[model samples]
Target: MRLSKLFKNAPTVNITGLCLDSRKVKKGDMYFCLPGMTFDGHDFIPQAIEKGAIAIVHSKDIIDKLPGVIYIQVEDVTACMNQCARLFYSKPSDKMTMYGITGTNGKSSCANIIKYIRDLKEPCGYIGTIAIEYGKVRIAPDLTTPDTLFLQRKLSDMVRAGMKSCALEVSSHGLSQHRVDGIRFDVAIFTNLTYDHLDFHGTIENYFEAKSILFKELVKEDGVSILNIDDDRYEDLKECSKARVVSYGIDQNCDYRAINIHENAKSTSFDLVYKGQKYPVKTSLVARYNVYNLLACIAALHETGMSLPVILQSCTKIPQIDGRMEQIECGQPFHVVVDFAHTPDGMEQMLRYGRQVAADKGRVITVFGSAGKRDIAKRKVFGELADKYADLIILTEDDPRDENPKDIANQIKEGIQNKPNLFVEDRYEAIRQAIDNASKGDVVLILGKGDEPFMYHESGRVPWTGDNICALECLKASGYGENNNS
Candidate 1:
């Protein structure tokens, strides 16, 4: 591409690519000097030039200019980068149907379901916590939402592969940083917002504003804004969004509502009330939270022009979402569920479900931990929820990166003032002990790290076998083999 096309008053040099990091700059690449909290990109100009970056885009004035390099000054490099990336990639999002989901939790599961439903009629891609995938390609994501340049490029690839739609998970950080600035969304879904990521956003209000960017700024004029009215933040979001609203929830008169809900150890059944009628819905997914996830997803699908019946049928065969209440049946007499409920609200809802699963016959044994350097205030809340919900609380390491695992566990323990709990430093050992102590009909709930493949510690992330596999192995060791139990 020509440099003149991306920026004004720039040299007509041929730009081969774009990059943000100086270390990754290649020959003919245009490196954008983006100032960040940790490191300023301007300081790395020499390195970027050395790494064959021919063009430099920065907001600050360069005191010492290097020869043979084209310099382009901008008022805002991040915004310019987003626009340039979109233009460079032919604005792929504009060429395809775009659906966005944002919240503290359920973003991944909702995105996956919307992608699956849309893909039924035409090819649709999915990008979120699990992985980015379209057709035969799947790439692990480094962030909830990738950098603007990488995201545009991926969407371009999806367009090239003939994908008709894309379901994306929008994060508050990504929105605040304008990562998805140039991309347009046709449908936006807001799952419930909870107390999480306070370390970054500083306050819940600021975080809510960041999430509001999607509905307030990104959704197209004619697009649909879907919200779970059951969520406490619904009124705030509804007031923020100018676009038409489509609501989904229970105990309220929503556009898409679920009523007559019932759940058991196997599945959940609900009557979905929409369009002045009620449709019987049954699914393998149990718990009220999942019903909320379902309502939000179906609303998006319906707004995207999918038939309600088809979407309901797809519900019957809902794909197993990784780490979101994923069950491990190793022929154990007791039940085991692994979930990615890291937030206080998420943990509370999941533990309630665990309690339901436990019923009168057993107890809910919970094993989870808090992340290092993330949110310190929420650890105690985790303990409080666990104490109220679980019978035995085994607090273990979740991702105590650069923070003492014992310290994190202790903070959580502070909340369990009267609960019978123990701090197990090693998570695998914690899982082993929890399973070893479980009796018949007990529901062992593994929280926090779901299907994640790595464990974070002071040494950073290392390869991990994940909780489901560890539970299966532990159950096998306890003489509960699938073959034998079946």
Candidate 2:
């Protein structure tokens, strides 16, 4: 494509591709010099030019301009990149039905559920923490919400592959950064927000504002905004959104309410009340929080023209989401659960469900740790929640990047008033100890780093088997097999 086609007012040049990282630059690629929190892309302009970049898009003036390469100056490189990416990709999002789900927790599960419902009628794609999947192609995501250029490119790919709908997990960071600026959403779902990502947003109010941008700006005027009415921020979100609002929750006043909720170790059944009608719904997903997720999914699907009867039927087949209260059973007498519950509220909810699974006959044992360089205040809170719920607690390393692992563990230990707790810096060893200590009818909950494939440290991101894999290995080592339970 010609550069003139992307930037009508700018100079004409043959544009082969678009890139943000200088290291990934190829011949004829237009390198975008975006300013980031840590490093400025403008600092790598010389390297990008060295790698045969034919054009440069930057916000600042270049003192030494390359003679042959085209230079396009913009007020904001991030905004410019978004526009250029949308134009270059032929605005693929406009060609398909798009759903954007935003919140601290349940975003991935809600996005996946929406994708699952949509795929029942037509081909659909998913972009979230687990993977970017469409048709037979699946790739691990580098970020929860990718940059605009990569996002638009992926959507374009999905459109070309005959996908009729796409589900996206929108993070607050992505919204504040304007990564989803140009894309129009057909349905925007707001899962409940909680105390997470404070290190970046600095305050809870700022976090809510960032999340509000999805409904305020991204969703089309005629689109639908599905909100959790039970959340405190629902009124604010509904007020800010220009689109039509549909509320869902356990609250009776909500547009869609879940009543007579029956949750057990394996599944939950509820009567979904919407518009003065009731539809019985059941799901294999565990936890009361997942009930909210199901409500959001039903509301979003209903807005997309799916009937209550059809949606209720589809609810019976909702697949178990990876890393969200996922179970690992190797014919062991005890049960093991792996979850990505790093926040204090998330941990409390997960442990509550773990207790239900343990049921009075068994003990609930929890193994979890906080990440470094994140909201440090949550460490002690996590400890308090663990102490309140779990019979035994194991503090271990969870991506202590550039911070001392022992110090992070110690911070978490400060809030435990009276509990049987042990500090284990090695994550794998912690899982081993937790499993080995568990007897028959015990429930072991491994929190943080769900389906994540790597562990971060000062050295770098090291290859590490996820919690599920480690728990399964320990179960095997403890002499449990498929035939052993019988």
Candidate 3:
């Protein structure tokens, strides 16, 4: 593809290779000068020119006057890059099966679950919180949904690598910013909408609008759209989309529903109902939300040409996604589950699931903290939900950024007026306290951090054990005090 194809309207500039980084610039590359939260890309324009950039695409400000370089100024560099990226990749999304899963939670899990099923029959690729994988090769992405050029390039690369199916996590930021524009979706899924990313998107409505863009813009003519009928936004999305729709929920009217759940310590078995028929499925994962996730995945695969029995078989052997209700046992007295339950809905769902497993003899002890410089409004809601369901709540730091960790903890405490809550500044120490305090038949929920590599605070991120590791260490050190194993 020539640079001429990208800016057919502009005509003057034509180039190959689009790079945002100066260090990666090649002779015929078009450099995009974007402004990041902390650093301005215009500052690196000189470095890009020095590296032999033939064409320059930048924001409104012309920081440097380069006499000979093919300079082009646009209203927004990010938007232009997303457009050019789609062009550069030859619109690879049009070539293969693409599944998009969005919402506050379950995006990654649903994407991975569907990928697990698809990979059993055909080469599958996934782009989500965990990593980007094409067949056996995996690459870590900085953001949930990468910038436009990177997005196109990666999809194009997947096509080159012979991937037949791809599942991607479509983030609200990506949708609002038009990062995923121009790609047609084979299946668009909504897990559920909740309070999240209020820092970027000002209100819940705005957040929903941003997330709705995936369905609004990309649902292809003949494509299938899988929706969680349980979410209130389902009707809104149904009205907005033009594609064929399949509804899945525990609700009676849903096209695909989980009629019943038989949950246990090791797994959860359920009867998956669809079109008046039912199939029995037992997954090695906990939580009723996971049952919903599984149903959505099943609906997506069925739309993508997979049989229900094969889909259920694929689900049976698939293990849990890390940091998503991951359980660790070392012959302990009680059960411990580590999860990334940051949102109110996620917290409530996890607790409800734990309650089912622990039964009457056990209590739910949760360790969690609100993130600094994030959706502050959700903190109180998180607290309220935790207070309502959890027997004991240990508030701790979760990516405090430059904000005071104690202040963040206090904010979460604001909503838990009636529940017993304890504050611990250190996440590791909080896990230790929760585990040490928990007795046999109890369920300790180490929440928030999940799979993060480090704990965040005003001091900045430091080397830290992941939530799973910290919980395991604490559980082991507890000497199996009150667990059933003893």
Candidate 4:
């Protein structure tokens, strides 16, 4: 790993140390001058060189008159740094099984589930929305998929730690940006694609193209393509994939399908129909979406040579994923469910289950909001869905990053007009309003934030827990306790 040998592929010089943060710069390290949306890295080149940086990798446009510094000017520094990172790590992903799960929703859940099961036998690494985890070491993630260099280093570190497998969440933004260009996937799981990130991709087609890159081009020939046939994009992906395809859904024609889907407030039990054979699988996790997620996980385990009985036995004790259809009952007469269903389709599904759980005398009241600066096109759709399903819609602020919270609320309000609801921009107040509107036989669904701990706004991120904290307060507000419901 000598500096000279590392930069042998470069036209001019080789870089030794890798760095993004100048404060962490080491002697002989290479500093990547990335031009972020907020701050330009070119401004830090002098500071980086002053801190004993041997060379600097930057775009040609930023070429300056730093005579002493070894400048490795490239057409694109971001792309080059990623390439160098892979080289520095000795391509460790080659030795390990890497599973790439992509889609609008359930990617994090499915990846975490697989990681949990895999870790039961051996050390399993994970990189996703939750965080990047390897054994006891955990770090909050800045992106769903880290930059290529960070990714390679993490993979190398996991391999050195005797980790057998890694479950990685591949975001469409990362895939389309060539951030994961060189890595080969051992398995690619598609949860389902829906309208999201339209502000970035411009259209759903472009978004799908970005996600398809992992399966269409990134996955290895011997890799397994775990697909949700229930997704509308499955047929197209199947026709284009070179890897071995395995399909799962509730549809009988699928390779793996769920049968007898019995879902209630406490849990869901179902018979999994795979290849004409039936396998019973029961889980404390409720909701029809979870049934699909379980099917995806089961399909992956099946491909790994795990017997149906073994898979069922191992996955039986799976705990409720925090903030994802997470249930909190403090002896209430009815139920309160929390979900990260921000999208229109997800909201509809959540409401469908909420109404089912609130059958007969019960009613369904929903509290949710659209995120700012992200897929604004879906705001009206989300509002329309909430209006159509919930007995009472409480529109509140979710994440109003860089966008006015009132403005975002007004957009959603426009669509939900003429409907019976409350417009409380304060998320906690919105939740309280929903709870106050609910009666003894009523269910309340708090959506959008899920397990997230922070409430993001244009001003700053504030401490908030829409689900867990709200549940306790709502219960107290509703006069429910251990002795109340009975």
| RMSD in order of candidates | 1.2, 1.3, 2.8, 2.6
Scored by lDDT, the top model is 2
Per-residue accuracy of model 4 over 3-121 as CA lDDT, tens digit each: 55556554345456688767777777888888776887878887888888877877856545577676777888777777777778888788877888898889878888888777776
Q: Can you give the TM-score per candidate against the true fold? A: 0.98, 0.98, 0.92, 0.91
lDDT of 1 at 450: 89
The positional error of residue 444 in candidate 2, measured at the CA in angstroms, is 0.8
424, model 4: CA deviation in Å? Answer: 1.7
Model 2 C-alpha lDDT per residue in residues 191-216, reported as the tens digit of each score:
99999999999999999999999988
TM-score of 1: 0.98
Clashing pairs for model 1 are none
Query: Tens digits of per-residue lDDT for model 1 on 333-438?
Result: 7889898899998999889888887857798898999999999999888988988989899988888889998988888888897779998988899999999989
Model 3 weakest lDDT span, ten residues long: 476-485
Ranking by lDDT: 2, 1, 3, 4
Clashes of each: 0, 0, 7, 2
Which is the winner by lDDT between candidate 1 and candidate 4?
A: 1
Native-vs-model 3 lDDT? 0.84
Cα deviation of 318, candidate 3, in Å: 1.8
Off by over 4 Å in 2: none
Off by over 4 Å in 4: 9-16, 21-24, 35-43, 61-68, 476-479, 482-485
